[model samples]
Target: MPLQPLLALTNSEPEEVECPAPAPAPSRPLTAEEYFSEQPPEGDIGRPRHLATKVQKFKATLWLCEDYPLQLQEQIMPILDLMASMSSPHFAKLKDFIQMQLPAGFPVKIEIPLFHVLNARITFGNIFGTETPVPHVQSIEEGDRISAVIDDACFAIPPGYKDATALDDRHCGLDDEEGLLQYAIQQSLMESGTQDDQVDVWEALRGARPVTPSPRSASPNLLNSEERQLQRAIEASLASLSVGPQQAAPAPPPIEDDLQAALALSAQEHSRLESELMEEQRALDEAIRLSLLDK
Candidate 1:
């Protein structure tokens, strides 16, 4: 019986046991909620308004990593998201965006978000300190500068927003919503200056001077917001002339020579004046003495 069982085993070939390959996973479609909810690892959601402020400036830092630093990349996500989301609502009409012939292909999708809080109907006088209503857009005559404030909300966009669409041609194209907003703001700012008694806001901010309205003038507010921006840019350029990248550092102060020269001049003047004063005093005393003697 044992020999018969061994013979049967020897004649039979091992059964082929085939394991089926695992099926591929189906990709889930990305929903709008998911796109917006994907917060940058640093949690940039609640503080966009603060981030929008250009006050806390930082010098650019260079890195040579093959991959972007996790920290730096994470920092820009919220800004990008904010810009993308905000522009979506107002400029969604591609009619203009298309005619603009955005550099990137048509139907370009910007993954970023716009700042919701920053969007508002910005009227000139409505925003500035005095609420001096700016004349209607039509009322603005050509070449006349107008004075207006960026509605509090317009100023609410975060500075890091520039980082979001930097790489996207579609987003970077002038037709994109961000570009349109920038163009509009720059235009508005420019139009305010030289539009007749327009206040130079760039100067006020830079010089830390209080803003005062310029007197009305016959000059048309010809300069668009873009032109105004250029003016500011020029001013900024001029302001930096003393410390430009190309300029050489000034030689050390001529401290010793200046001090010695000042001292020498002071001494010479002091001696000359002292002698003259003494002579006058002596003459006065002699006259007083003679008067007393005569009396």
Candidate 2:
């Protein structure tokens, strides 16, 4: 569906990046072809990337939570849906965010909370596309830095939401958001079913849970009853993996001149890759440009 960017009016969150609604209006999320294709749609303005959050220290753990002004969850949900439809090299930020867990020495955690959007507006022509270098998707390093900023913001609970009394008296406002973030994290950990004493909140946080690999035959059987069937299955699988043509290897005991020839071949290979890389970069740029277009 077309996504509308909400504007924050009051001094609620520290810093928020809100996109201006495009002309003709986007009624749905950008298609993968559009998101990755060349040229922005007719009206897309740009994707805004800004860091905004609030922090609080409750007992031993430090809560690192975003103060989102949009009740629609514009920060993460749309990106997630886009990720579910695309592959590698696209929507990589969402992928990396899912894998990020709080590290030791910081006593940090992540939670989602909300605020209100007082009003909204639309900006004229795409400000970014007209520029020499229109903005592109963030790199892994840039994404990591933003993640770190969200994690490190907690020096202390903001002015009021410190003691239990503050929490008890909380209402549906900014302070409530802060408490909600902390409470959400606590609830998640409690639901994990770890014994209360076992989970020292200050200890290093957990990483994504590991997935079990499917079982494979540990040892091949030569004379078992199913040996014939196993051999046929293996042969069929191998046949399906036949690759395209490849250069034959040189003789094992290669001569000095042969090595020199191989070096020349390697140099030629590098030159070919360099050309391919330039084309790829050009295509990537076009894709980013078009992604700014309205869906």
In terms of TM-score, which candidate is strongest? 1
Pairing residues by index, what is the TM-score of model 2? 0.14
lDDT of 2 by residue, 1-295 (tens): 1111121122332445455554656677787898887886787534433455643211112343343222223445576567656544323533333344533322123221122432222112222233232344222234323221123334556785544212233222313444444433333344364314232222324433323221111122412322343334334334444544573332323223433233334334445767899999999998988887744
TM-score of each: 0.17, 0.14
Provide the clash count, candidate 1: 32
| Clashing residue pairs found in predicted model 2 | 1-27, 1-28, 2-26, 2-27, 2-28, 39-290, 40-290, 41-293, 44-293, 44-294
After TM-score superposition, the amount by which residue 202's alpha carbon in candidate 1 deviates from its true location, in angstroms, is 23
Q: What is the C-alpha RMSD of each candidate to the true structure, in Å?
A: 33.2, 33.5
- What Cα-based lDDT does every candidate model obtain? 0.37, 0.38
lDDT, candidate 1, 44-136, per-residue tens: 222222112122211111122332212222543454456555565334322222233223222212211123223222111222233344433
Candidate 2's displacement at residue 136, Å, is: 74
Output the number of the lDDT-best candidate. Answer: 2
Candidate 1's TM-score reads: 0.17
